[model samples]
Target: MRTLFFRSASPSPSNSPSRSTIPTSSPRHSFSDSLMEENIEMAQTLITKWDNSDVSSYTKLTSLFHDDRREAKEYLKCVRDLQSAMHHFVNSQDSSAEKLIISQNLMQSAMKRLEKEFYQILSENRENLDSETVSSRSSESRASTRSSVSDLESESEDELMVLDADQVSSIPMADLKSIADCMISAGYGKECVKIYKIIRKSIVDEGLYHLGVEKMSLSQVQKMDWNVLETKIKNWVNAVKVAVKTIFYGERLLCDHVFSSSDSIRESCFSEISKEAATTLFGFPELVAKCKKSPEKMFRTLDLYQAVADLWPEIESIFSFESTFAVRSLGVNSLIKLGEAVRGMLEDFESAIQKDQSKTPVPAGGIHPLTRYVMNYITFLTDYTEILADIFADYPLTLQTPLPEAYFGCYDVDESPISVRIAWLVLVLLCKLDGKAELYKDVALSYLFLANNLQYVVAKVRDSNLKYLLGDYWVGKHESKVQQYAGNYERMGWSKVYASLPENPTAEISSDQAKAYFKQFNAAFEEAYKKQSSWVVTDPKLRDELKVLVAKKVVPAYREFYEKHRVGLRRECGVDSLVRYAPENLNNYLSDLLYGASGGGSVSSSFSTTSSSHSRGR
Candidate 1:
């Protein structure tokens, strides 16, 4: 209060940038030297402390430079100078004292700062300094660039023009030979690709071959010398490209320890290289048109194939998702051609084998040589069984055919071995017979293999029926047998097995266990029956065959049930009792009498005559 002087305290910072005339925009480097120097000093101190295992007193001591910009800048300048000196000390030839004085941490700090500045500059100026921007700058700059480029281009054209007949033919060949030697020596695949491109371009656009033919007789060369040479050169270039691309692409850098460094470097190279190659080779407007119009014709050219063949490894390596798909479409066409060739060769071989077989007789030993050969062939065929089964699993809906036709398709004895044919027929009967034929019958072939004995055949048939029935296929023809099996199954106390099936036949079944098997078999039959041409007539001839089986199974069973329980069943299921009972007792009693009296369930009721009539008679 002596002078009544006071200093106003600074307000606390708010969210918004405060307005001031203090040039708070910052000197940019007001804190720069201090910030960098302090950061590096702190980092170095921490690193030294870490290296020394001094963890007790490592709290940041960076506050001194934070508040005083002037002092901070001065300190930072000194630190930066120290950092630069350390870098120079490490890099310089004078080793003993400088090496001892400069630490790895100080060198690292300098590198970090240098790298940060470089990246910042690059990021900020990338678009401004790019090729397109540089090309379109001020008219003076553009004109100067154009003048320089034009002059170089003209010089190149003049050089091209000066090439005589001998020179044109000899130059490229000589250059290729030298490059090939260099490539073989250095194993520089990228350089090889570049050389090939130059050669190809010379042959195509520069009329190198026309010059080559100047001294030769016109008749010795093709009418269009440049075009023919271009085609050949293109093929060669493509082959090299493919090889290089495969080397770069197919081998994963991380996985292949031998090629890790090279692969990593090549991957970076390929990213930029492949984009240029794709645009040049396939994405060019003319090439795109060709692809769209007739891809097979365009890609199938020998030149293209040659190019691809040479660089298959590189092509494989560089192939991305979109690229692979495009390439494979081309490959598929090639495979089709190859397949046709292979098919022809196979037919010839098969013919020869058949002729040889016809000439030879069966051996007299315990095993015929032909029999062994046939067994081998059978085994070979069996190998495909797994493949076919896999196909069926993957594409169950593919099995669309009538049951009989499907049976024929399965057995196909005319084209298969007797054993295989027999096996197939068993499968067909097991899968499709509908269980209509009586046990131990002629059509059922109940005596064949494991198909004998009513109990055995019925069990086998029961197993088959259960599999298909739950698939939502009716198995209507085998319904009675299924019912019979159900009765037997219940009597045997197979509650779990019975429960595995739909509890009510009329009700829908839902079981995860049966889903896959059910889906396949049902799909097969549905596809078969849904065909319009299956029966070939309004009244199919097989109708009677099916009905006969049904009648044999149903009629006798119905007759026996009626004969044994007619009186009792009539009494229980009489129309008056059915109507009198209405919805409750009627359905229950009628079902019991109808199915239970037939012995699907236990029945306690028996016929009873009136007691009044007996008393009257006595």
Candidate 2:
């Protein structure tokens, strides 16, 4: 019963049964047969001195183990010797049961000292043994594992370097490893593993806290306002990358290194240390996904989903044990929830475009408010094409009853499904704007509104990431529609102006008929010019192009009519009274139109009375 309290004094008594850990022998001889009896005497010195209450020897023994690292190795060697002594005693033909009990008691004393050393090493070297340094110095045999973890880290290398900058490798990995081997071999693995789990788990938990991760419940996230919640999501994006690439990654390396001699000890220890923290880190995204479903929220949500997927390989490799399976499941479930959230928001956005109720038309057939909102919204969505590709694969926009080929164009929708969906979103906005155009009372103004809005949408696509997804072909096709809308506007708005001029201005005609022709031209020109002067073209390139086209259509023809009739129209009446405009005047008037400014003094308002009299005379 000497030294009986050694086992009871341990923080957690070992329930693991004692196992013989002596090395295997050559086929020719038993290895334990050759070990010296003197090897057992070395450990007995400290065990007997302590148990016998030899105060001076006890103080010296404690000093040798704690203050001298050189002596620490010598202590580990004594444990190994004690282990061999016990085996030899059990297998010997002439062994005393009393001697075997004394050897066993000495072995327990050595294990108690070694267990204290193990806990001391872990507690004192938190920074020196941090995951960053540990993962970098991981054993060569785990090169494949380290390589895979490095791949996850490459996803966000600059987010937070995680103490690698001023790292000092002060934790002697070899010393911890040597002590672990001695204690675990002598059936004290439970005590060694318990100390490891407690200290390292705190490091893992605290690491997450420094990285800005917290244990968020579904209710807390659900009640968070999006503005506040979105800030949290951005922080989680950086936090998760650091947690996986540094925190869990370093721990996996350190645990596998220290307990490399026992696969089960290393696996179980790492599982307990990292599982809960990892689960909470990964579960944040899923909770965020559960909270909201809005188009405005989709981009930040995709960022969360991407963080999980990018680290999934590392998560799988680090937590590969059956004991840590819940960590891997947490990561995958996050991906699934974030994906579901993205799809829901996309549908919500599509529905919002179709259900718009802004009934009032934009002033002067300019860009509608909905066009600006939807185009800006959809343009930004194109930034997440790759993640959206995975999401949209399952929730395809079903074109059950397709619009006419003219509305969208003949481009193939199958080349990329993502492109098709974005194209469809733009089409829905165009359709919504088409409904808005109808609110304008003037048919010409309706075409002008469509032209102005379509030009805005095309310009948005060409300038942003949307250009890559929608392609130059899509851009070209819509650009032509913008021209087509402008053409329709010009044809309807100026048909009366074209009608007032003679088909053949140089053909000989009576002075009275020529006077009437000049009279009719001024009235048609003034009214159309006055009305169209208030319309707008929002895009600069389109605006300049429309001004040029109207000049080409009107300028030369009006110039020809004036040159042919000058003498006859002056003889018919005062020429200035009938010809209110020259060829130069026509160009000037067209320039002043379509800028959203109301009527300036008309160049030809004097001709309106003559035009009214002519209307009655006709």
Worst 10 residues of 2 by lDDT: 599-608
> How does each model score on lDDT?
0.31, 0.74
**For candidate 2, what is the lDDT?**
0.74
Clashes of 2: 0
**TM-score between candidate 1 and the true structure:** 0.21
List RMSD in Å for every model shown: 31.5, 12.8
lDDT of 2 at 321: 97
lDDT of each residue in 377-408, candidate 1, tens digit only: 22332333432232223222212543443223
For model 2, residues 1-618, the per-residue Cα lDDT tens digits are 233222122222343335546443222223343343566777787445434233434443453333554455566677788788888878877464876888887887777667766776777678778887776663553444434333433333244234342223422455577778888888889999999899999999998889888898999999997668888988999998888888898999888878999999999999989988888888888898888576667678888887887788898998899999888888888888899888888777788778766666777888776666677667767777887888777676677886455554536334466877888888888887787788889998899889988999988988998877766777888889889999999889888888888998778888778778888889988899889888887777777788788778777777888888877667544777878898887877887777885322211222223223323322
Model 2 alpha-carbon drift over 4 Å, by segment: 1-34, 45-69, 136-171, 402-414, 570-574, 597-618
